[model samples]
Target: MPTALVTGAAGFIGYHVCEQLISNGYDVVGLDAMTDYYEVSLKEARHARLESEKFTFIKGYVEERDLLMGLFETHKFDLVIHLAAQAGVRYSIDNPRSYLESNIGGTFELLEAARAYPPRHMLLASTSSAYGANTVMPYVENVRADHQMSFYAATKKATEAMAHSYAHLYDLPITMFRFFTVYGPWGRPDMALFKFTKAILEGGSIDVYNNGDMSRDFTYIGDLVSALIRLIDVLPERGSAPAGETDSLSPVAPFRVLNIGNSSPTLLMDFISAIELATERKATCNMMPMQAGDVPATWADATLLTQLVGEIPHTKVPEGVAKFVNWYRDYYKC
Candidate 1:
């Protein structure tokens, strides 16, 4: 069996990735910090569900160079998926240091280890927030995204640059994918779907940011996982990009960035209505202004993703929301 190392293995997306990898007959090593950003128990519960002989779990921060180097020395990882990072746009404003430590510092550590013990392909997680302040309807990979609205996005962008330099110098095949508002079962509590579900179930009010005027290209977790698995095989080759393609392939390095999203921006209110339909409960709305370090909208171009993966995410908002609601009710016995 091929060996793969997945960071943030306890996170919402990471857990699903590990599950899919194990099911496909891969020996997976999973690492998670189990941080209390939202609820550590929720992450623990997700990890617990994946316990098996094929899945090895390690609890530690990826920023720890010693821990990461030790793991690299022991296991010859064929593929390295770096999903662990400090996530959240709003939280980054209050705690910029955390983002620096986890997003920038941690990624540097991973790159160094990968240099010493190279993996076949290294995939890193980036956010659509990195497209900060861009008015582009559907964000394409080739566009310049230097104007980041949040510290979170800035750090993620930095990692993209950092990864590219390593790829150029060491010939490490690296692919960085920017995710656009990922949601589904086992989602994070800080996200809109999870918070709205809990509030609606408890008959509490949900905070509708930007007075429900915001929009997002909410990619379903299952669809995102499928895209990721496909990308693992589509490694970047130096100077091999086809002509006339909007490829973000680095001219001097085997590195590229892809945007993985639904490509359909749904209104915030419609997303809330999906929750209401799923839960059969009317939400008391607290229409609030857009929070600091938040964009009013986000949509992905996803042309490159389709060109590479041969498929696109097509999960409709209502259908995906219904699945999350069902999982929440069953998991919490609500």
Candidate 2:
């Protein structure tokens, strides 16, 4: 079995991705710092659930330059999935340096490590927030993302550029996946889905940001993991460039950026309604103005992803929300 190294294997998406990889017969080495970004217990619980013979756990921060380099030297991994970062839009405003350290510096460290021991392919996590200030519906990979509202988005965008440079300079195959609003079982407490579910279940008011005018391309966790697993084998090449005739693929490096999303922009109220249906409790909406560093809507143009994987997140809101509710109720002993 090929060995895969996952940077944030204890995170919401990282846990799911690692689980899928282990199920698919990959030996996964999980690295996580167990940061108290939201709840360390949640991360621990996710890691505990992934206890398998094929899984190896390593406790460390990604920003540890020498440690990460030493790890790459020790394990010649077949693939690397970089997901550790300072996530959340609002949190970025309060702590901008965290984003710089984790997203930018951590990525630089990973690239430096990859330089010594190159993997077949690397998938780095980028967020739909990187599509900052773009009014265009269904954001595409080729879109010029020059304007970023939050420091978080800026750092993620910077990672994509940094990864591309590494890909070009060291001939490292790289894929930058820009994730949409991913939600499901093991979802982060900071995200809207988790917060709304918890608040409504406890008979509290749910904060409706932007006066409930916001939207997101809510991709289910399972479908996103399936897409990612399929993409593991479709590695880009350094010399074999993508045809430039209206193609979004990178020209200089063996690197490509893809939007791993549902290709559907869901209304904020609609998402809340799905949660309400699942929880069997109406959410008391506290209408609030749009917070700083938040966009009104995000849709993904996943044409490239569809062509590559022959699949995309098609699970409708009701179905996905119900699954999450089931997991939440069972896990929390509700």
| Full-model lDDT for every candidate | 0.93, 0.91
What would the per-residue lDDT of candidate 2 be over residues 1-334, giving only the tens digit for each residue?
Answer: 8999999999999999999999999999999999998889999999999998999999988998787888889989999999999899999999999889988989999999999999889999999999899998779789788999999999999999999999889989999999999999999999999999999999999889999998899999998998999999988786675534324566788988988888988999999999999999999999999999999999998888877778655899899999999999998988
Off by over 4 Å in 1: none
- Among the numbered candidates, top TM-score falls to 1
Residue 224 of model 1: what lDDT? 96
Model 1 alpha-carbon miss at residue 224, Å? 0.1
Candidate 2's TM-score reads 0.98
Count of clashing residue pairs in every prediction: 0, 0
Off by over 4 Å in 2: 241-246
Quote the positional error of residue 165 for candidate 1 in Å. 0.4
The residue-by-residue lDDT of candidate 1 on 12-79, one tens digit each, is 99999999999999999999999999888999899999999999999999998688888998998999
